[model samples]
Target: MTVSDQTLSTAGTEVADGIVLTDVAASKVRSLLEQEGRTDLQLRVAVQPGGCSGLRYQLFFDERALDGDIVKKFGGVGVVVDRMSAPYLTGAVIDFTDTIEKQGFTIDNPNAQNSCACGDSFH
Candidate 1:
């Protein structure tokens, strides 16, 4: 409901329950939103069954606020995590990295016991 100022860099900002968004990640999100010129979308993070390990992380922009959706904000960026995916994402940190080796958003989840080598799935 409340929107504040910008970015969390290396450290992260905690969401409604336990998920986190690093400042750089937030800035990237905000940048994306600005590029799209849409204010109704929120970054939705969810876990779905599939992938090599078992469950896979899903991240995307969403406008629908489903029932049981958990919402939180980091600066002007809003984030939503469904009730079912909440537990799996506990203590999870979402960050953006742009090194010569790799570039993109990454999730660091403490709840994952085992993740596939390709990094797309987890158990």
Candidate 2:
């Protein structure tokens, strides 16, 4: 498989096919990495079945790169996606918000035709 180093932009956020980590998101990820003190960790993003809307997302720090993993680097942070979950996560944007009302990483997935009420699961 070919990995493109080219960068795509959405709302000023850099992107790739499977996933895009925004500037704020990347910064947060880097900060978290520093806190964890683990250089081997990479952010893993995956799409899994069995949510109310038929699909759910899993995002976390992973130390192992499984077989068939698609790895990309964004602003010094490594993001990994497995082959199976790649298609469903294409054109997805990950952003971090620090608003007073809500503070966390938010995902904007164009592939999701429908999503559950809680915004955790999508089509």
Which has the greatest lDDT?
Answer: 2
Give lDDT tens digits, candidate 1, residues 5-116. 3333333564546778877888999999999999999999999999999999999999988888887787668988888999999989899999999999999999999999
The TM-score obtained by model 2 is: 0.89
Model 2 stretches with alpha carbons more than 4 Å out: 1-12
Compute the lDDT of residue 58 as modeled in candidate 1.
93
- List TM-score per model, in order: 0.89, 0.89
For residues 1-123, what per-residue lDDT tens digits would candidate 2 score against the true structure? 334457666675677765779989989999999999998898999999977999999989998868888888787788889999999888798999999899998989999999999888999
Q: Quantify all predictions' global Cα lDDT against the true fold.
A: 0.85, 0.86
